[model samples]
Target: MKQRLSLIIGIFIVMALSNAIVPVLPEYASEMPALQGIIFSAYFFGAFVMVIPAGVLGDRYGRAPFITAGLLLTLLSGGIILLAANPYAITFARIVEGIGAGLFVSCALSWVNMQPDHTRLSGLYFAGLNAGLIAGLMGTGILNSHFGQNSGVMLFTGLAVIPLLLSFFIRDTTGVLTNVLPPVHAIGWRNKWLYFSSFILVGISGVLVSLYPEFTDESPFILGLLFAAMNGATICASLIAPNISLQPIQTIRLASALVGIAVLLSFIAPAYGGIGGVFVLFMVIGGSIGFVFVSQMNYLAVSEKLQGTAIGLLTAASYGGMAMLPFFSGLLTEVFSYGAAFLVNGILCLLVTVTIARCRCALPE
Candidate 1:
């Protein structure tokens, strides 16, 4: 078995760095609600752009180099953000950081799917991923209080070194390289619905994190706990879902339904259910997102020849969803009530469920 500790550490740091600014978005963008959405989506946009290319190139060259390069970029982006004089610089830094994340994630996941005991390892990988999100959310909130707006970014940037070093030790899982393009029709086109599932399912959480800071008047620390609660549930679900007997498709369907219901309920949770209700709703959303990720990965398995490309495409869709949905959701927030925004998102979830149920081809056996 490959010593995957390095991969875990690398992913954790990358995820934490990706989200370190979430809790302080309002202050970071200060008075410009529109810029907050732009700043938040910038990373996802970078990731979306980089993932497919990284995946394709990784197949031809190697996954290990991209992983190392990604960490390096992460470190560089952190420095940029730390010294940034204005919002434009910060946004640019975020895009660089996101590009790093897209490279690491697609390649890292392709590496994981190739290993023995992949199901178990995938669970562990996702657990670390969500744990990093929680740490970034909570830690940044705490640090922001004591230090300043960039404090969390500084701390996470410093923490990124451990992974950058660790990534060097990861041996390439794909032993052979080919110059031929992966069969996009087989890996991506035929499975478009599943990819769309990735888009709609995981995206629900992205919408929350992007909008929540402005949605509530809670302090950064309290907001951190709230976001952390959701991610904590995500970690738990990722760890446990792989152990269950359900088929990957079955698990995805169930989780998607729950996510849809939870999003609908979130609108009322703030009023009738109070803060506690909101917390519970967040957990429901988080857990469903976790299940969707694990099941989606397990279900999307392809031959070694197409593994990197397949994982890359799936990741691109996921990040694409994360990037576009929240920005659109924020737009909806501008034009309509928050309740209306949630309603539309919730309906999208159910629509995804229907699409999945209707999808007859390219499903895992």
Candidate 2:
């Protein structure tokens, strides 16, 4: 019981540290677009680079070691960001932070699902993750606005230390789930259709995650505050999500639609003046963000075998799209304007919403 409590604390710390960049990217990127984009990559590269290894290692050995190492990496990354000046420093810091995020999530979820009260534990995990994200973004933005960028980075560094403190409690788990367990059938290479369908919906969410840095630049303090607003709405939506009753595909389709509409309202009309439009945009973005994640997580939990490995794969797909899209979005902004970029991206999301709906009806239940 004590072990689980500590583990939860560790996971929350990891999330907060991992997301510290969300509100601070604008400050870090001041004249450095590459670093801003690199912030996304820092996380992606770490997660993507380590996904396969973490999976193989967690399944073959145990999930705890990876989780421990990852936490420390987060601490290292936080330290770098706190002193960051150039794009290289920022990107490198993200790389370390990403390493920790990748390890913690893949293995931590694996460990939790093995617990006696798995469903409740899963809920707690999601709750903690969302809550931490809000804290890191919100806290950093306020700190950056009042203190300076270094202070914002230091805030993450401080949070990063919290997870490492949990190392003492995570001694062993009695091997709840193990690699020796027989594997279940996976979608495999033939499931490109499933991946392609899922990928676009991820992009719909991904664009917004990437856009946050730019939005924060508009108002550093508000950027963090807006992120908290978005997460708050998402937590509410997820709470009521079960009652809404739609299968995985249907839920994702719905979320895609909401996101598309939100993007249009935010980018096209910029309704209710500048600040209000951004605020509303944040509201819309938050409400729809968790839909795809929850939907996909449900699918993975039920459909995939070697759950840890499968979750890693899911993270890869989700973050992979997130990492690449921002650079493209940046390029688009360079070519035209942020407003135009948002409109085009929103259109892309709308198109995917249609594709997913059409595919859902065609696929067997």
Candidate 3:
């Protein structure tokens, strides 16, 4: 139980550190508004680059060293951001943070999967992730509003120290495995399909994270509250996931429908009911994505040998979507409007969900 708690807390800290600057990032790039998306994507781009290798290596060696090394890198990245004066420097710092995130998340997930009660633990794991995001967004917004950007970055830097300290206690479990695990290619096509579908679901979250602040001109406090509400909903959904009795595919389909509805409502809500409507829809979307994420994690955990690789690939795909989709969504926003971009992406999500559901029927049981 102590180990589980520590791991959960470590995961929470990593996620919080990753998202700490999200609310303030737009303002940070106000001087170079045209590059906001690119700047925002640098972190995920770094994660996408490193996740696969981290996964493979973590499986071969042990997760503890990687987790610890990742946290150190995150610390370094935070220090860089705290001192960075130029956009280029900040972007580079974000990439370093992303690589650290990839290493930490991939190894942490694999560590949790090796535990006995992974299904229940998976829920807690995701809850910690969302809760961290909530803390980062809310805390950063409030702090930056009062103490300024440097202070906010410093707060994040301070928070990183706790996890870096705790990571040392995480057990290296590679010694317990009796047989040699197969290569990455051993992960079957069915799992790949599931990963792809989950990736699309995650893209909705990326879009929300990257662009939601720009959707409104409200105060930072209000924006923080809105994002906090959404992430709070996600935490609630994750906590409830263990009790859900639906099969994986059914859960995925339901989550897909909910996310599509939320997106459409997001477009309609602001125009009609204003921020309140959008807030409610964002909560729904967050909950739906939570369900999708936990379901995918549970599905991947079924294969003991490939659990690390499967999760690594899934994480990579997720960050890849985060990196690519939101950057284009930003471009779409420039060409059209936020509403149009949301609508288009929402429709694309629905289409991908339907196609994946159809493909599932053809897979060997």
Candidate 4:
């Protein structure tokens, strides 16, 4: 129970602190439109590079050390972000923070997948993730609005200490396995569909999140609430998705399609439906994302020997898409309209869905 609690809190802190700056991105880097995407994606880039290594090493060594080290890195990154003198410095700090998150999340997820009731536990774990995301968006937006720009940074930075301290008491469960694990490349190829699906599904969420602050005309506080609505729906869906009777592949297909349609519809929401329409569409997108996430994780947890490598690769794919998609979409926004960029995102989801459907690889039940 303590281990579970620690993982939950650790994920929550990492997610919250990482996301707190999202709502304020436009104000944070007002003059650097071209660089905004880079700033937003830097963390994902760092995380993308680290997760696979962390996962592979954790399987051999111990996940507990990596988790502890990750928390410490997270703590350090927050301070760096707070004191960063320029956009470059802030971007560098974000990358450092992302590395910490990748280490903690990949290993923690591997640990969860090794457990007996991973489906239910993973649901709760993802719930913590979305909850932290909501807190970050809403809390930071309100705090920054009421106090100052640095207020939210200060608050979340201080809160990061809790999980770091908690890491000391959490147990490590590394035991030598005589059965040799498959090579990382082989493990990744075996689960290519899962990784690809996770990449596109989570990447869609990233596109909305990374670009929305600049896309919307609302105040920072209101923007936070809007983003919160999306994440709030994600929390609800994560908890409920595991109980659904559909197979993992079926759920992924439906959810991915739903998220695509929702994103496409969002182009017209603000103009025709107003803030309420946009809010509902965002919720749909979030809910769909939650469904896809849970389904993919469930599929990946099928093999105990492949747990760390598969989860790590899954995470790396997700972060890679998050990093690349938004950065490219931002460039599209500069050349075209936000609507055009969003339309492209919707199309990309549909393409990935079609590709997955045609793939011959069967999903684990």
Supply candidate 1's per-residue lDDT for 230. Answer: 91
Over 1-365, each residue of candidate 2 has an lDDT whose tens digit, in order, gives: 65576567776777677666776666667877665766756777887777655765676687878877888887887777767777688788777777778887777776665555554565556667778777666776667679876675676577656667766567545543564642423433433334554555455555666676564455555655665777777666555554443466676667777777787777644435576677777677666755555555555555554657666666666667666666677778889888876787777667666665543323225
TM-score of 4: 0.90
The lDDT leader among the candidates is: 1
The residue ranges of model 4 lying beyond 4 angstroms of the native Cα positions read 23-30, 34-37, 85-87, 174-182, 213-216, 358-365
Per-residue lDDT of 96-133 in model 1, one digit per residue for the tens? 99899988888888888877677778889999998988
After superposition, the stretches of candidate 3 with alpha carbons farther than 4 Å from their true spots are: 23-30, 174-182, 185-188, 336-339, 358-365
- Residue lDDT tens for model 4, 135-159: 7778787798899987887898898
Error of 2 at 207 (Å): 2.6
Colliding pairs, model 4: none
TM-score of each: 0.92, 0.79, 0.89, 0.90
The local lDDT score (0 to 100) that residue 165 gets in candidate 4 is 81
Task: Give the poorly placed runs of model 1, Cα more than 4 Å off.
Answer: 1-3, 24-29, 174-176, 213-219, 302-305, 360-365
Q: How far is 344's C-alpha from truth in model 1 (Å)?
A: 1.4
Scanning candidate 1 in windows of ten residues, the lowest lDDT window is 356-365
> What root-mean-square deviation over C-alphas does model 2 reach?
4.2
- Clash totals for all candidate models: 0, 0, 0, 0
In candidate 3, what are the lDDT values of residues 214-333, reduced to their tens digit? 676677677778778888888999889878754567777778878887887787677788988888888998888888777777766654465567678889888877777776888899
